[model samples]
Target: MSSDPLDDVFNLEDRFYTQGYTQGVEDGARAGRIEGRSFGMEKGFEKFLESGRLAGKAIVWANRLPKKTAKQKDASEKSSEACTLPPLPSNPRLEKNVKLAYALVEPDTLSTDNSDEAVQDFDDRVKRAQGKVKIIERMLN
Candidate 1:
């Protein structure tokens, strides 16, 4: 009756705007939850695949190598050389003395030896050591 059209118009617009804002906020929250769940699922699946691949690789490595005694493995790692178990022969005598010569060629364990004989002995031991390693390598392939 007073012709306060401006007040009515402002009030109606404000109500509409508030309703629109509330709807927008609810829609955004739902969308964010969906995106977050999707991302989490993807990461979990990726980790599962990576772990499966590693397990498979470990199986392959275990199959290729014989069941080495802990002592042999430890000794090999300590000596910085590959330790391998040869095939079991019907006659133990037929098997060559695989560990015939011993000398510390490992740079860490090498002792000071001034004599020529010691040097020659060390060289021959290394050669025999290398031959044994070669035999093991050939069997692996």
Candidate 2:
């Protein structure tokens, strides 16, 4: 039966402070998680959009390559065994075209001044890209 009034008061104050500190930490952690998720999703969406644009341009350039002839198709089919793949042509010109096409569409290749821009001034850029694509297409001839 030791009822020390000062000890009770100190215990009460300590308990209240601990409760408040725990709640604050939990609230801060929750907010941080929400912000982190939102930031990640926004960045992911931007990357997805840029990848789509790059793929579209790459597809246009890829279409410039010759289609597989019947003989090539048969060759590919014959090599369709498990873990086996058909070989691509050993043409250095084809390799050069592929590298140039990928370089043209790669996000990393964007100019530093425009890298962080939200909206692109794409009219002139698009025309120049099309001109490059045309040159690559002609190279296939």
Please name the candidate that would achieve the greatest TM-score relative to the true structure.
Answer: 2
lDDT of 2 by residue, 16-59 (tens): 99999999999999999999989967865665466446547566
Which residue pairs show backbone clashes in model 2? none
Q: Residues 16-132, candidate 1, lDDT per residue (tens digit)?
A: 999999999999999999998899678645544443443343333333343258987566465444435333333322123222211223333432363677556545545555564
Residue-level error in angstroms, candidate 2, position 104 = 14
Predicted model with the maximum lDDT: 2
For candidate 2, the TM-score is 0.44
Q: What is the C-alpha lDDT of each candidate?
A: 0.50, 0.58
lDDT of 2: 0.58
Off by over 4 Å in 1: 1-5, 69-141
